[model samples]
Target: MTKPLKASGFLGLATMMVVGLYQFTLLAGGNAVPGWMIGGHAHLGVISILAIVMGFAVPVIGVTGRLRTAVTGMFIAGQWGIPGVVWIGEGAELPFLMPTAFLWGICLIVSMLIMLYATLTQDSSGIGGEATGVTPADD
Candidate 1:
């Protein structure tokens, strides 16, 4: 897995944690939590983890060259884009944010589908060394 993807994942988790702390502080201060913040917090965690997993998955699925680059970029974009637009849109009370969020979500789904297709069409017909009972050390 690449460092960038893992770093992004960790960064997302850190952001989520910070948001959670802010939410707690808000509650403590007798302020109501905003719905947009809640949504952003959730997405930060989810997308971050997905980015990390996809980092490991990309090479396993044989996604190389330009396609790999595209998919990785897409996932990285989605890791930050979804939550960012949501927070900005909802925080600023913009109506267009929801559609933008949907678009980001769709981007994530498309990235996953690309990796899935690669996995499905592989010659081994299985993922990782375990599927074939062959360990990396054997290779």
Candidate 2:
């Protein structure tokens, strides 16, 4: 994988971690978190899993156009959707959580855009290179 794609994948995983932690905190604190928050967390979790799966599946298939685009789109949508649901829909009042959520959203958005570019421009040739059955590069 190219540097940007690797970075994007890491950022995507980070966003997933943030979403999961946020949900777990909410649930564990017994604050009656909104159903939308739970749903949003679930959505982000699914996106994260998809990213991981595609990261492996793409190079395995040796075809890397449509699936990449779809994953990028889903990542962008989930990143924005989570914040929209939390801040706008639920109106969460925790000031400290806001910054983390905002940063996570921004990272996810930028990373998704970069990944989308890599996907469209054929720059991430080895994105799924370690999915087994493929020769590993010496470098």
Best by TM-score: 1
The best candidate in terms of lDDT: 1
| Residue 22, model 1, lDDT | 98
Tens-digit lDDT track of model 2 for 28-120: 998666766666566566555555654554454443467455545555555555555565545665445545555556655665565556567
* Local distance difference test scores for all models: 0.84, 0.57
Clashing pairs in 2: none
Candidate 2: list runs displaced more than 4 Å.
1-10, 64-139
Q: How would you encode candidate 1's per-residue C-alpha lDDT over 1-139 as one tens digit per residue?
A: 3567888998999999999999999999999999999999998999899888887888777887777877888888888989999898888888677678777777788888888878778877545744555566854
